[model samples]
Target: MSLPDFDTFRAAQAARGFDEVVARSWAPDEDVATHSHPFDADALVIAGEMWLTVDGVTRHLRPGDRFAIAAGTPHEERYGADGATYWVGRAEPG
Candidate 1:
């Protein structure tokens, strides 16, 4: 099956109580040091690839892959040579 489009992602985000929906793109071979966000996140890899590290486990993410991170979970990110573009939904802690 194919990946969902921005419209589909937006609808899901709204239904899931994610008040913010953003499109994020990383530069080729970019590396992000360990960090954490203030809100929960749900994302879909729509282009290229990325590595997501959370709790010391690294996950290779590709197009159509989905991942989620709870608020304040320390994590790291690395983008592949072609970089990556994703649609992310963020929900603040209630």
Candidate 2:
């Protein structure tokens, strides 16, 4: 799928009840050890590639790919050589 503009992405997330949207980038070949967040996340890759691991399953993600993780899920991340950039929508559980 083609990538959406930030405005469009933010609007879509808001419509889906996400409270905030932001851009995030990782350095090339970076590895983020296992961690968890306090809120749910919905994200789309905007550039480069990454490996996302949740529940011990790893997914390779490239431009235009989307992923989601539930609040408090333990996950790990590794960025491709060229690094990665993405737009993420976050929502706190009600």
Q: List the residue pairs that clash in candidate 1.
A: none
Where does model 2 exceed 4 Å of error?
none
lDDT of each: 0.96, 0.96
RMSD of each: 0.7, 0.7
Q: Give the per-residue lDDT of model 2 (tens digit) for 1-94.
A: 6778999999999999999999999999999999999999999999999999998899999998999999999999999999999999999976
Model 1 stretches astray by more than 4 angstroms:
none
By summed lDDT, which 10 consecutive residues of candidate 1 come out lowest? 1-10
The TM-score measured for candidate 1 stands at 0.97
lDDT by residue (tens digit), candidate 1, 1-94: 5988899999989999999999999999999999999999999999999999999999999999999999999999999999999999999987
**TM-score, per-candidate, Cα-based:** 0.97, 0.97
> Which whole-number lDDT from 0 to 100 does residue 67 have in model 1?
97
Error (Å) of candidate 1 at residue 35 is: 0.4
Model 2 TM-score (2 dp)? 0.97
RMSD of 2: 0.7
